[model samples]
Target: MTFRHAADPVAVTADNWIHTSVLVLNASYEALDEIAADRAVVLIIGGAAEAIADRESYFAIRSTRVEVPLPQTIRLRRYVYIEHVPHGGDQSRATLAGVLRRDRHRCGYCAGWARTVDHIRPRSRGGPNTWDNLVACCVACNTAKADHTPEEVGMRLLWQPKAPTHRAKQQRKIWRQLAAGHA
Candidate 1:
């Protein structure tokens, strides 16, 4: 509810609210991103966005001029243009965690749960740490294919690997809806 400060009744401590996540929506009510609660409050107080939903239990953020409820979801007052940026292209460096997430934690060789990543062209032979060269692998598969290319071990990949696509299509659809302003 209302939090009062000992020194100044109008000031609320930001420390407690900094970790809370607030969902952000576009002007057209399309989901965009999640940001910290403090940032959401700033956007709301600055008149850049309005709170669409508040936390069930109210947490008051008090300032000299105003006191506002902490927001759970906020929508921008105006549409914000988003440019799609490609992530981790073939030549770009790939992290072990990123490769695992891209493969859905499934082994690319046997479709089993994976805990590690394997280089398609073994790192020993100078495989670059790129999206196309890495795949999620189970312990057994990684051991079996150690320091060797898939073909050398007579192993076949379940699927070809590539860089993950961004949310370009969904963003485009949201832009179209914003333009139409359909009821």
Candidate 2:
């Protein structure tokens, strides 16, 4: 698809195009990230990147000085180095906020609204603050569970907890492609 901005061929409101997805490419033309159309336009105008592909339906973003088409894909003008961080393991400590977000703030036992976190294996018994050991819990469930393990209290867990997977595979594939191109 292509976009035209000259003479304002068609009126495109910011509200209509702001939510559009724009694929971002690194300076080497490797996929980097996906960002909103408005942000992409800002990057393009700021001279940090240039549009590689414009949307098929021409949408004009007009200014007193110039106009530009909404971009479908953009490439950075300079190479950006990003440091990779390893995903946390089962032994890694988890935060209360992280646990709540992972469970979508729903009780692990009853699927009710959860404002607190529960330890599957009681902390008193040496349960670590790891992703696999923590679960979001409602106030009532937390009180009932006390310092006892779920098995001991006869309360079955609705789901087994584990460390959340980051986009490692996708990132590896992109890296491989970049390596091959360099070779």
Summed backbone clashes in each candidate are 0, 2
- Superposition error at 115 for model 2 (Å): 1.9
Per-residue alpha-carbon lDDT of candidate 1 for residues 48-92, written as tens digits (9 for 90 to 100): 789998876678988789998988799988887665555534333
For candidate 2, the C-alpha RMSD (Å) to the true structure equals 9.0
Candidate lDDT (C-alpha), each: 0.78, 0.76
| TM per prediction | 0.49, 0.55
Candidate 1 stretches greater than 4 Å from native: 1-25, 28-83, 86-92, 168-183
Q: Judged by lDDT, which candidate is best?
A: 1
